[model samples]
Target: MYNKELIRNISIIAHIDHGKTTLVDRILEITSAIEQRKMHEQYLDTMDIERERGITIKATPVKVMYTADDGKTYEINIIDTPGHVDFSYEVSRSLAACEGAILLVDASQGVEAQTFANTYLALENDLEIIPVINKIDLPNANIQETISELEDLIGFTEEDCIKASGKTGEGVKEILKAIVDKIPAPSGDSGAPLKALIFDAEYDKYRGVIVHARIFEGTVRPGDKIMMFSSGETFEVTEVGIFTPELIPADSLSAGEVGYIIAGIKEVSSARIGDTITSADNPISEPLPGFREVKPMVYAGMFPGLPEYYGELRKALEKLKLNDPALVFEPENSPALGFGFRVGFLGLLHMDVVRERLEREFEIAVILTAPNVVYRVKMKNGEIVEITNPAKFPNDGEFEEVEEPYVELSIITPSEYMGNIIGFVTSEKRGEFKEVENAGKNRVVLKFIAPLSEIMFDFFDKLKAISRGFASMDYEIIGYRPSDLVKVTILVNKEVVDALSFIVHKDKEYAVAKKVVEKLKDLIPQHQFQIPIQAKSRGRIIARTDIKALRKDVLAKCYGGDITRKMKLLEKQREGKKRLREIGRVTIPQTAFLALLKIGEEDK
Candidate 1:
């Protein structure tokens, strides 16, 4: 049996591209977890999308055995988490499974918005934080400045911070030593009943659900009966294993151990993250304190490009949900786009990533509608309804008031771009400036309260353009506030396209409607008859554009004809065209729906 005192559970948290994965690579090398011939960069990032994007989307756990200077071997469990605000929930789940965390900061960039957000998450979880200055080998690395920011912002002393280069493996040994010496060993009673927290799970076609868990008390072995606390479903554990960065079969997993369990759970929803697992025969009276339910901030419709692929899309989403519990979807029907799911996401990037994964991984061509935020509407009869789809929203006279979601926005950028960022956020994005703080090293942190709908489309892209890619932002939904929000419906040839409808603020309704109608006019293919693209708001047509009909020259056949003959031919052609316009049905191409999602760029 392994000793509990020799095991350490820790996680590495940082901002995007702050070198968390690189640091994990160095640690794996120093500890000799994988053979030199088999090792590669970002070894823990097993997904193709992760490698291509150069970002970690999922939190990955790995186990490495290291020999300390005192000649004693120790088992270390490290969870490498994603840095984007959209995936901060992944970081929180990783933290819940660990006793300590390595707070990583970019040496040149100093403290960033996500760095602060992640640090606070760790603090909330009561994890021991060891500050690390990463990418120290760069010529522009300002280690001292970063260390100072860590001290002033996070209250970590100079000695508590470790300077390291993930590329050269410099100070890597110190990181390992700190994990063993500073971070406390896991505390649990092995003699008690089994109690493990399901931090994550994956689906294998042959093996079923492979649950990643951290054991807090007692022991679990093959053939033991386990039960999920939330679902009350019991299963016979078939095998237990540890991630030597890969699944390696183990005899048994005891208290203070981090590993996986294959319990023949065929249904993906049975093994939920944050659900407690314990002995089926001798169950715990109360479940462990689970994580807070994650509420999606942005919502959009995802439909298959081919109507026949709806079933395949559903299966793919089920499997993806097994891995990402943050994604929520439900079946919804649209008159224009057939049938699809209304999916909810944490942010715009999260929505994009899910769509890309659906296409690239599952090979399902998807059509995504314009993203929107959920709105609370109070009717004249005093009934409040939450609307996620614009087609379901009440008409102007039916609702007394409408409230939209807002977020607490934090931005960290250089002082030079502060004015431009402030002007854009306040004027264009409808953001209310809160305060500014000096973050040392000529950088400033700006705070704002912005409507989630305004930032859902192109806020981040515009921020990056104005700041020249130096600005980083993070936001959290701060309750709803009353707003003059109206639903803008799009029509092609006087037929409503439910999928193209979106909700917008009343003040900017005309501008947004004009943009959408104009974009649709260019995207929708011309038919035999004229197609009028119109945007409707508050029972009135606010903006309209026309796609000219395809015409055949009647004059070409009238060559050498007299003027009266030409006029008669022209009159006949006009009558036929008018009849065709009344009966012709315009088919809106799929590209038009996709293009309408990006109408915000025109405003920029």
Candidate 2:
């Protein structure tokens, strides 16, 4: 066991691509936590997706022993957190487990949107912030400018900011020393009842659920009976361990320490993130304050390519939920796509990541429908219903009012792109201009209140193109507001395809409907009979198109026959074609569903 007074719990926080993972690599090397031969870039990022994307998706914790200049060994726990706004919940949970944070800023890029958001989160948690300017080795790096921005934004002086290069290990020692010297030690009674907060968890085929937790009081070891405070389920502890970047068996974990505990939990839902664990016999009267539940901002349907793989998809989703608690799904069926689940995600990026993981990690090829946001429908009877799927929306004259979700968007960009950005946001995106302010030298921050659906699909992509990839954005859901929203349904050969239905604003319904019908006309293969593709909205056909039939030469053999014989043959062929058109089915290919996702992209 190590001394609680000598232990410092800290987390590394920064915006996307600001070198948080690279900095952690340098820290691990200087502390001698891993052998030189075993060390690699992003050593703590165990997932292949994280490495391929070059971003941290999960908050990883590791313990390292460093001998300070005082000739004494100190135990330091470092939590590496994600910088994307979609994964802000991960950073918040990590902060709950640490006493301080290393706020890293890219010297060349200066302060972006997420930098300000994460710093405010740390301040709310009452954590000690160590400001560090990273990537100082780059030729375009402006260290003095970054320091001024940090002071103007967060009120940190030039002396408090440490200039470091994550690439060459410059000033790493100063960071380590600052962690040991400035951060406060964890204070708790080791003799009190056992209380550990479950910050994260993962599923294992052999060991079941392995829970990562931070101990607040008492000690936990193998053979002790523990209970989950939320579920009230009891189990005997089978193992206790710590991450030296990899799981290593430990004898025991006491208060003020972070480690993993295994209770042989076979059910994935039992060991939830933000759940509390304590001694079953001598449990604390009150549980520690847990994190607030996160609600998904976007919803999409995920159906397997083959129906037989439904069971496998279900099992895969259950195991993934053990690792990602933000993901939520429910069973639903579509006439066009068959059985599937409606999965909810934080944003478009979150949806893409989850879908990729499902395909790569679980080997499940899933067909995703177009994404949509939650809408509120107030019926004429004064009843309100929240709709995530277009098929569940009420028909016209049935609902008195419809409300859509709205967000408060913040964007930081160079001053030159401000005019174009504001024009695009207000004119094309239907956003209301809120205000604009100066962030630092040659940079400005723009704020807007926009409907979430307007920006859900391709808003970010357009912003990047207009700003030349220099702008960064962050948003929070403000509330729901009344909007003129209508549902657009697609019919292939006069049959409704539930998977092709979507919700759009009333003014843009004709444009969207026309695009969907025209795209389907090109994608749907030619059948034995002509097929009509129609888009319906508000009980009217706003757009229509047809796929030409593949015809056969029925009169080829009767070339020189008499006029009466040719007429008889022609009449007979016409009747057959008519009969076929009445019962023929149009097979909609999977590519058609994928093509619908790009409809909004074309408008841009």
Which residue pairs in candidate 1 collide? none
Model 2: weakest 10-residue lDDT segment is 595-604
Q: Which stretches of candidate 2 lie over 4 Å from their true place?
A: 380-384, 550-578, 600-604
lDDT per residue for candidate 1 within 1-604, as digits (tens), equals 5999999999998888889998999999999999999999999888887888778987789999999999999999998888888877767778899999999998988899999888898999899999999999999998888877787678888899998999999999999999999999999998899999988888888999999999999999999999999989999999999998889999999999999999999876788778899999999998878555677878888899989999999999988887776789999997768899999998877888899989989999998887778899999999999998888999889989999998999998988999999999999988999999877667888999999887766778889999998898988778999998888888888988877777777788899899889888888887877888898998999999998878888888766957999889878877887898888878776677678866833352
* lDDT, candidate 2, 52-104, per-residue tens: 88888888899999999999899999988888888877778888888999999
Report clashes for each candidate as comma-separated counts: 0, 0
lDDT of each: 0.88, 0.88
RMSD of 1: 2.8
What lDDT does candidate 1 reach at residue 495? 87
